[model samples]
Target: MTGVVGALVEAWDELRIHRLRVLLALIGVAVAVAAITAVTAAVDMLSQAMREQNERDSGRSVTLQVNAWPATAEAASTDTEAIAAQYDLALERYGIEYSSRTLYSPVPVRFPDGTRGVDMQAVDPDLGVINRIVPVQGRWFVDQDVDAFAPMLVVNEAFMQSLGLSDLSTHPTVLIGDTDPVRATIIGVTAQRWTGEMPSAFWLYDQFERWWHVDPQMGQPAPTLAVWVPTDQADALSERLARDVQLAAPGWQVDVYDNRMNGMSGLDGATRWIGLGFGVFALLLGGLGLVNISLVTVRYRIREIGIRRSFGATSARIFFGVMLESVVATLVAGFVGVAIAVAGLKAVPFDRLFGSALQDTPPFPVSAALVGLGAALAV
Candidate 1:
């Protein structure tokens, strides 16, 4: 141990003496490690951003969507209602924890100048959880929001702007319905899906039903139920749910499908491998450059090696001492590179890239730091 310590001290002293000569090589190592680590972290963040975006569009992972329609055109309106009731019954029978009923309908809203038609979604409270809905202002729907006397609304930025409002601090209210025009309160504002997105709003299913009834003759689509279940059980429950709904409403076409796509995970995996491939290529190029510089450094110290050989330094000790110099230099560079990568990750504009802030921003991956350090040691 003492001999190893002395050798390490000697190696460090040599590095200090020739620091200027090794500076360029150390910089190469640092840059290479930084590239590997930053690329790895960026890939992770980008993948997560994409996954969240997908979740917002579709429902969360492993969500089952149930839809039903009468097989014959002669089916009565009561049959449609029965089908909807059966969907709810199936959900209840399975004791599904996260479920929602979603319906899209266009409603007339009184703007400042005149009334305009606005697209609205009437959804149960669980839709917020199933769809990963995050409001930029105020809060998402809660169970109690259903019981409010006035209809509660969560509108997009464009919808809020249409009302000539910038924020929800004043508790804004807008007249809804073409004939009756029940005053509805805007409780929250969400970001527009894209720039110049048309005005849209969301309402509690019960409140929407109590106020504005959507008629099928008006070209409105029927409400569909979404139930979030475990991935392992999605296939099994899909068939069972479909069968149950079919049994509840005989002579109806009932279908239950997994709404969330499985492609996101595969896409993320591909991105990780591609990013790592490029990182590895960069590391190899940097390593080659560093090796050339180290060779020149060794030649420059040939005289020093000869003198140490005469002073009872064995060939094995001399070899290890020289090898230790590169190891120690790379170790120092690894630390500097990891620090730079961490800072870069924190500085990245995640919201701009992902279209929204990530609900769960991952911490700096320990694997990234390990990859950087491992590359340094290998070089």
Candidate 2:
């Protein structure tokens, strides 16, 4: 340890002695590290944004959708609701993970201007967990919200503006239903990524069910369930869920919609490849820069190295000294570059820069900095 410390001290002194040369070499290394950080961070952010966008368009991969279609067109929606409720018990038993049932229906909501029919969706609060429905202003619902007297609502920017509201701090309330406008409290504002200027309101199912009347038009659209399961377990769980539903209701048609089957089910694999490829590219660049610097440094110190050898320095000590200098200098340059990159990212308005598809610009990807440092060290 003492020898190592001595070597580090020597490396620092040499760095100071050859400050201009070291600085010039460091510039290339610093730029390379910075580029590595930027590419890695950008790749991660873009990939996640794309995933959220995909989930918004299609449900999440391994999303198990249950369609309970009764034979009779005139069957009351209440009957369908009861059948759907049966899965809750079975799910708990199987320990089948994350699930949300969404009921989509046209609902009349009164804005200050006039009442308009909006795309009303009632889903559990955890829909954000199952699918990425990020909040722009407020928070998504919680299970405890069920006890609240007034219904909690999550509205899009367009819907909030349509009602002449800008600030989300005050818990805004809106009226639902044509004859008697039942008041509902606005709890959260969804980032406009998915809705994109469309007027929509998301509600917690039980709360919204109290006021919204379901007039059976060809029997209300079956509750589309979004179920999350491990990739390996997805097919089996879907089968079990469909079988269970069929056994529970003799005449009902249980259609399990596999979103992955549609296309691009290989997103996980693709993400891995993207990360690996970017990492290789970054290391390649950084390695070349560091190698050039190391070569120049060795050439410049050849006389000093020879003098040390003449003074009885072993080959091992010389090798260790050279290696230590390269590593310490590279690490220092890499850190400086990381600091520069992080500061530069601070100026970026991620939402505007990446477009609202990425609601909030994520804090600088820490993995990026780690990868940058790792590359600098390895080089």
Candidate 3:
């Protein structure tokens, strides 16, 4: 232990005396370490954001939609309600929290100014799964509104701007489904949705009775009935739904989109490979620096090393002393590099660059310390 301490002190002294050379080497090491940390940190943040977005887009619970026709047009149709109940039971049996909603095809809102586009979605008020819309403005619909003759509507930002409305709280009048222009208050704006299939819009299930207007609800020109389900159970639910639909109506097609399956699912394996490549490159660079620094120290301290050996110092001690100096210099550089990277990252608007997807990510971990220390010693 005393010998090790003596060697460490001597190594530290040597490193101090060659301050300029050590500093230059440290800078290279620090830069590499910092780069590694920054890249890894960014990747980690993005990965987490993708996961969260997936969860938000494709709920953690599984959902299934079934469109069944009544045996007779006048026979009180309870099949749709019954099938929904069965789905709910199956989900509960699987220990999955589930919710469902019945939607009308998106309704086209024709304003007096000739702005024609589909913007409204009618939904069940009680279903909690996908009913909660991230409101950028007012509030979601209440149960009473769903039953009212003239129900309230929630509009999106794009819809509001198109209608020449400045504030959503002003209760703007808009036309729905070729009906006479009815006045409904704008309750909320949707979070900027990037889906290519639908234009920006708001909820209006309370105001319009979509089922009453369309014949063979499935044959209607608009998309109706969206069900949200858990990611893991999405495939199973989709299969079950297909089977249910076939049993009920063989001519209708069932479609499913598991939000969890979107955006960079295959990238995990690619990212691991990329990370490994960078790590190997970093290791090689560190090793090269270590060899160079160690050789230089050994060459410069031939006389000192000889004297130490004469005084009973072993070759192992001399080698270790040189290695220790290199290790310390490299570690110091690594830490400095990590600090600079962290500070620099704060200056960039990462949220804007990556989108709202990663706005609330946690700070990068300090595990880079281990990497730094290990790389320095290896070098």
> Which 10-residue window of candidate 2 scores lowest in summed lDDT?
72-81
lDDT digits (tens) for residues 1-379 of candidate 2: 9989998998788788878877877787787788778777776676666666777766666677887776654543336655666778667877866777788888888888888889888888768777777778888888999778887888888888898888677778888889877888988887665545779888888776776777555425566677877778888888888888777766767788776765453664576577668756765775676688778778987998899999999999999888887788889988987887787766666656556656444667888899888878877
Model 3 agreement with the true structure over 221-256: per-residue lDDT tens digits: 323345665566678867766565445443334454
Error of 3 at 221 (Å): 11
Error of 3 at 285 (Å): 4.5
lDDT for position 89 in model 3: 58
lDDT of 1 by residue, 1-379 (tens): 9999998998899889889867788888888899999999999888988887888888888888887766765543533676678777877888899988888899999999899999999999998888889899998899999999999999999998888899988989999999888999998888888878999999998898899887775644457889999988899889998888778776667788786566887899999999999999888887887799889878988998999999999999999999999999888888898899999889989888776889989889999999999988888
Runs in model 3 deviating more than 4 A are 49-79, 85-95, 102-104, 108-110, 115-119, 123-152, 166-177, 180-182, 191-199, 204-213, 217-263, 279-290, 357-362, 366-373
The CA lDDT of each predicted structure is: 0.86, 0.77, 0.60
The prediction achieving the highest lDDT against the true structure is 1
Which ranges in model 2 have alpha carbons more than 4 Å from their true place? 1-14, 55-62, 71-78, 112-114, 137-139, 144-152, 168-173, 179-181, 194-196, 230-232, 258-328, 342-351, 356-370, 377-379
Clashes of 2: 0
**Please, what's the RMSD in Å of model 3?**
4.9
RMSD of 2: 4.5
Error of 2 at 222 (Å): 2.9
Question: Root-mean-square deviation of each candidate, in angstroms?
Answer: 2.3, 4.5, 4.9
Q: What's each prediction's clash count?
A: 0, 0, 8
Listed in order, each prediction's TM-score against the native is 0.91, 0.74, 0.74
